[model samples]
Target: MIQDKFKRWIAGAAAVSCFMGAISAGAAASSNKLPFNDIAGSFAKDAIVRLYNKEILSGTTESTFSPKKSVTRAEFVIILDRVLGIEPVHSAINPFKDVSEKAWYYDAVTAAVQVGLADGTGAHTFEPAKAVTRQEAAVLLVRALNQTGINGSTSAYVDEEEIASWADSAVGAVRTLGLMSGDENDQFRPSDGMSRQEMAAVIDRVLQNVKWAAALNKQSNATRIQMGWQYGQTTAQFEQSVFQAKVTTLSPRWFFFDPNGVVADNADQSLVTWASKNKRQIWAMVGNRSNQEVTHQNLSNVTYRGKVVSQLTSYVQKYGLKGLNIDFENLAPADRASMTAFITELSTQLHKIGAVVSVCVSPDLGSDWTDGFDYQALGAVADYIVMMAYDEHWSTSPKAGSVSSMPYVNNAVTTLLKVVSAKKVILALPYYNRDWTIAKDGSVIASELTLVEQDSLVRKRALRPTWDAAVQQYTVSYQLNTLKHQIWVEDGRSLAAKYKTVMDHNLAGLAYWYMGGASPDIYTSLSNAERFYGLSFD
Candidate 1:
């Protein structure tokens, strides 16, 4: 594996991700030095560029990566996602009860649970959204390294004077993994949440692990990694990380569907066959929701053998299907608790048949959607939660905001954790953008579009491009004679930045809005994920 190439622990272990371009293999990674460039002019610019080139911590926009901003839980998810994207998404491993068929990170959460990327804090609920404390992050980081086949146990927290005794192992793990070594003072502040700069450095170090993992996966040409989903609190840097995981996972996101009886698409069949043979975990969406009210009535037509359950069972027996992803959207609000119930039932059924269950959730907490969500109950029912942190800026909203801002995402996550668990949480990032239009009457409507197509409209004069600062997107204003319109389109750089947020907070993984927008360049970001952690393919 890529992780085996380097010493299990770096001596100096400088803040690796803090300096861009520092993660490239073979360039000596030094330790115990000022990891960043503080030069006021050109030196600073070079420093930033170095880190950017290495795919460390690029800023929010093309010109700046706000090195000083605090790294929130969502932001952290992106960082980890980027690194894990390169590894193989594991087959459903751990089992969390709270994560349900409707939870967003269902796929990733299940995989994380199986492989130990996410550990239940108390109950089975994987808090898909919540801020991560320093110690919590440390523990997760250490565990992630272990998952990558790195077999060293870190030092125990011995009241290192910085943090309490309980977190000594976590702190040591982070340091030993080469993610970071505290200040020159020799104190590992286990309780302190990491800073943006600190996180950048740590994420970079984790990337090295991912790199190592990837090298190992590539050693045997026949061994292909599987990719799935991850959800996070923000969209900015998380995008990059999601893509990175794809490469690391070496699998494609299954067209997670909500078919009841069966679903056998030519495309799906091909992917499923590849996954089955390779022991890969593709998305297995449940047509019936947690509510068990029949999430999709027409599923029987799409089932493998006329029934979704039968199809799934057949797949497991014949194809070695790894896990199941639930994408049951737009249910009656009254069905909320039932949603969890449905997943519980499904989990029982799937488990009886030997498959993992996962669900996609909105960025909004369970309160946001009452119909089919009892997050705690759902998490209890399934393996993980895919916190779909998108649509913050709806195409059809009265007000405009970032589709998934760090602030909003943090709030959403905080609320979610109150109801769910963190270990099994899988934060999601939007791979697409929302374009909005404003009418003279203050009416707003928006649509999801790809970066290239959105840009094309601007270049072709179909729409004028204007920058929308509130949402951190480029909006074009035009009076179609009398009506005004605006659109939010995502660029490669912006998407890359958004994807990193998934890793910052240590979520199991991330998920995308859909599969079509992903191209080769966007996909390459996952190339470095394997070295850091093992992806739960289920």
Candidate 2:
């Protein structure tokens, strides 16, 4: 009976050994198939895979990456050191009381301290096992990049007061550099422990931004066109304006197409001469006057379309014009194909004469106004596609809100970039705001206000404007005589925020809707952004 029991125990032992070997083999095979088993649906999966392919990151095990695990202070330092290619420094004296000469991370810690990438916690103690907080990681990242005296506004964050004083500048710098962002509630959780996945994502952003900076440096000599549309302003008025010195291209309302496909000649020779003397290219505007039926009638007929193209090309040759701005709006969705064909022919004819063609398109908001534009097809033929990213709350809207809020414009650009090339797109900004009045019966009426007018009204009425972080604009509201009035102010601060989108995307340049409505502060904001991005007016 004792011999029988020993045999049964041996058989059980063999079965257990085989099961362990199968697990090991399966793990090896899975590792060969993918970067990690646990990171299949992770938000940082791409970042982890990229870093792993570069041999800059490794998993905790053969087949599983602990993406959600908290990253220790010492581990982050080692990763940063590897990315920067900092050689480990050996020292006889250790700076931290917790680190020893025999420890594996001792040299890495010493190198990081020597390079000013990190510091001890307190009392000469380095908590190597402690998880790195978000604030601490931000400080270290700024130091690693060697950026000094960099500062950005932290007012966008709701929990700005929670950020430590020592890390204020560092956190702001990272936020501006696009290396980090706040949570959904716009709170920067400064004291929260950063997970391994967050570390990989931040590192990946750093690498990408570095590459983008290098590319910008190489393209410093390439001129980016800064254009502005002019209306209700003559040549003398334009010459006396501040925008004359800030823009590289001037688009004037020169030609208009009537219902009979007749091209109206509003072209001013004096303005053309002035633009040439001032070293600005004249991209004459050819508008449809928002007549949907006229546009359809003209574009749908082959002979009429060819006649329109011939007239435009003739005007280009007649005025010695450098370019043309096709401003067509308010069309039926069925005219999508015809609109593309018209632009294609116009662009082909203009290209032969060595003149550029830029087509203005409204943002694709899934409405009939935007559905008529085939962004991909238009981008293929036109030299540039100017996005009219405004009118979120139009004149006839039933609601009272901001016309072109921050989120609205950002989403518009993000969606447009998917179908068009960034190099071929120009963002058009509004120089005006809207004042809405809601009556006792709940009817809303909106009136337009230029930047200057909006400012004067705010001061005259003694109304205080509050900054709306979510919309990235200041708003004023008051009740007078049984009517509620609301105004969304567009000033230097809001314009600067919009300009950030241009720099972040490496877009072609900016275009103001109309130069007459712009104020001095608007030009100042643009100049500051230009200097910050290492971009000239052109």
Candidate 1 TM-score over all chains jointly: 0.48
Q: What is the lDDT of residue 351 in candidate 1?
A: 88
- TM-scores, one per candidate: 0.48, 0.62
Clash totals for all candidate models: 147, 1
336-423 in candidate 1: lDDT tens per residue?
6545555665577778866677677775544435445666778777877777777876666788556776566666666667767666
lDDT of each: 0.49, 0.76
* Candidate 2 residue lDDT tens string, 1-538: 2223223323332233221011134563574456678887789988988876555566666566788988889888877766655445443324355887566677667666543467789735889889999989999987776555677877899999999999899999889878887999999999998898999999888766756335323333436678888866777776556243378888888898887667888989988888888788999999988999898988888888888999999999999999999998887888899989999999999999999999998888888888888999999999999988888898999998888888988998898899899999899988888999998888899999877688777767766555576997768887878789998777655676787788789889888887867666467455534433443212
- lDDT, model 2: 0.76
The local lDDT score (0 to 100) that residue 318 gets in candidate 1 is: 61
Q: Report RMSD (Å) for each prediction in the order shown.
A: 15.9, 21.7
lDDT of 1 at 168: 61
- Candidate number of the best TM-score: 2
